[model samples]
Target: MKIPEARGPVSAGLLDLLSGQPGADPAALANLHELVTVQLRAAGDIIEDEDFQLALFCLYELHYGGLEDVDDHWEWNPGLLGIRQLIEAPFEECLRSAALGCTTETRLPPEGTLSSDDVAAILFGLAAQESGPSMSRYVAKKATLEQLREFLIHKSIYQLKEADPHTWAIPRLTGRAKAALVEIQADEYGGGRPDRMHSALFARTMRGLGLEDHFGAYVDSVPAISLAAVNMMSLFGLNRRLRGAIAGHLAIYEMTSSRPNQLYGQGFRRHGFGAEVTGYFDEHVEADAVHEQIAGRDLAGGLVEAEPGLLGDVIFGATAVLAIDGRLSSLIMDAWDNSRSSLRAAVPAGL
Candidate 1:
């Protein structure tokens, strides 16, 4: 991915640091750290703060496909790692607070033990609750071709790399849980068929509408909350300690995905697009229906049953999905409701 245009001073400084030698330059890192501290302190809402979110997104990007022209050595640079840690601490706390507000009633048995079924039931209940402002309904019933294109751009940040984040937890898991995750991810990765990988499928969807399918091509066009959504996945998946959170994240993700995807496919078809453009959403409608069961029962539930103490983290992970995604959906719908593009900038007119 090309290095994104800096969102503010921190991203600008981080991009500058990456452009140079990848080393512990105390003065440079310290200056960047000071900028980060000040920015974070001044941020009214870190989740929607462009500077912090963009900086964090760039930091996590190093661990993924990496930025264009950035040295591979920076992936493990101590100074960069410290900067990432500084941002992650507050970002995580913000997520936890938001998630707790949503899942206050979710609890485990008094014995501090639960079967896989019990855990799945709790997650299903969370999924069943009605969150306000449905993006799927808007896409299905009313989105213009341009709004749909804007929708894809917001999604491109994460969908183009679909399933990679949760895959991080596979090695961190064991037994039924590991098997379940691998099972679901196998489907996501197209079961060894590269062309059929979910990312590739999403790319196909983008091309059908004449949008750039390259990962992160639309990073600059999306708002901070859009980037924050993807960063949350990386934050949970990369840390072994957050294995439970990642598991629950995937579970809720799969649980909530099927219906919206169905509606998304409908929206595209309503715009007169054929399977080439709609296949990605059509595929998710069925795949996630099955995946939801496996993820809720075997992946998240199995893990919590095996390690009882992780129940809170598991629930937290599931609810965090709701909190972040809810905010993102509302942001998009709010913009659209008022006759505007959801993206920071409008995408080109599509084919």
Candidate 2:
């Protein structure tokens, strides 16, 4: 996507640099550092920092699918990477402090205690016990068509490339963990059928709503909270050191997915949309039911079994997913409740 209109000095500077402007000099970097330091020190809310979070999102985007007309070389440039790390270190710390509690009290699975079945049981318990705000329930029973469309827009940021973030772990894992990841990813990749790919199915859902289905088409419209939710996955997935966290994230993601998708599909039907419109959600209702099992048991459970030390990061990842998603859902639902648009104002047409 074209660089989003900047929200603050750092973003403004970065955008100017990307546009080939010459004013983003050391002064801009100094301004960025000061901004981050302030946000880091007295930041009241990590989940809602539109400026900081969106800036970080744009940095991470370079590695995934670089922006149009941006220099590809910037993806690995030391200067850019340094700035990213400066931002990311605080963001990661904020997430950990906000989500994962002290590890000292968390019980570790005893040596040799981790089996596939045991892993499934733990994930199942986590899923069952999670009581996050039910965005899906609201959508099913109370959402207006416009609200549902907005929900789809927020989701499309990630759904359009649904399994790619987690797939980064495929090479980081080995033995049972590796095999299990491949199994789940195979289905996500549509098991050799491009038409059946989850991303394509989501695209169909977007089209059914008369929304744009192209990647990053709605980036300018979504709020930073929405972007941060997706960025969390990419962060965990891209780092080999965070493989356990990614696995845990995926486990919880799948475990929590099935039921909500059922509700979402129902909401679509309630709005008079047919199977084609709801097919993406409908498919998840069935697919995630099975995928959750594999994810929690073989994928997550197996990973911890192989490397017991990763248990804490795994749990941290799961908790982070809950925390971030809960915040995003709360923001959207609250905005709609107050009769405000959850999205930023649509950008002016034709530039």
Candidate 3:
């Protein structure tokens, strides 16, 4: 994808340097890190801070499908890593605080030797307790076709690359946890049918709505919190030390998904969309019911049982996803409720 438009000076300078020849001076990158430190210190709510999130998103993108003309070698440039850490430190702290909330005391099971079933129950209970104004319900009963387009654009940030984030944990785990993750991912990948891959399914929905189907097609339109949600998963997944967190994260997603997906499909169908557009949500309604069990029990619970010490991190991962996604949901719903567009930039015609 082409480098996105800069959201602020930090992102602007970072993008400028990223376009330099492979081997831009480490000292120059260090100077850019200094600018980031100053910017973050004065920022209010870094979670919604567009410049910070965009810069972080671009930096992380280096490890994914990189920018159009940027040098791939920057993926590991020591200077770039230093700058990334500068932003990551505070962003991670904010996420931890959001995840903690009042649930910290009750986030985990009592201390003891717990079986996978026991752990699964705890994860299941966590998901069941998610009660609030929901994006799904709005999508089901009220969203206009334009609002639905906004909804898919917000989701496309992550859905376009579904399962890739959690797949990072495959090599980091072993035994039941490994097998469980692979099984879930296999289905996400369409079990050997390329066209049925979840990402492809999502792209079809985009096109059915008269939207572009390419990855990153709408990145610039979504708000900071939308990017932040996806970044949280990547943060947990890419770090081997956060293996437990990523496992818990996927489990939370599967556990909470099935019912909401049904509503999402209903919303699209209410507008008379056929199988072509609603297929993504319809697939999830069925798939996630099965995935939730494997992910919560065999994947997340089994990992905690084997490692014993990662239980806290597992809970953190689950709650973090809830926290981040809640923010994104509110962003969209709040805008809709007030009769405003939720995107950072207005979507163009037919989008």
Better of 1 and 2 by lDDT: 1
Candidate 2 residue-wise lDDT, 1-351, digit = tens:
657777776677666655542334656655665666665676656556777777877888888777778877767766667677777776778778767542223254786677767766766666765445688999999999889888989999899988989999999999989998999999998999998899999998888888888778888788888888888888898788999989999999999999999999999999999988898998899989999988998899989889988877887888788778877888898898899888886733422
- Residue runs of model 3 more than 4 Å from their true location after superposition: 102-112
What is the lDDT of every predicted structure here? 0.90, 0.81, 0.88
**Candidates by TM-score, descending order:** 1, 3, 2
> What local lDDT score does residue 48 receive in model 1, on the 0 to 100 scale?
88
lDDT of 3 by residue, 1-351 (tens): 677889999999899999887564766677798898899889867888999999998888888888889999999988888888888888888988998761533354567687898778877877876534699999999999999999999999899989998998999999999999999999999999999999999999999999988878788899999999988888888889999999989999999999999999999999999999999999999999999999999999999889988988888898888888877887788899999999999665667
Off by over 4 Å in 2: 21-44, 101-108, 347-351
User: How many angstroms is residue 8 displaced in model 1 relative to the true structure, after the best TM-score fit?
Assistant: 1.0
Candidate 3 clashes between residue pairs 3 or more apart in a chain or in different chains:
none
Q: How accurate is candidate 3 locally (lDDT)?
A: 0.88
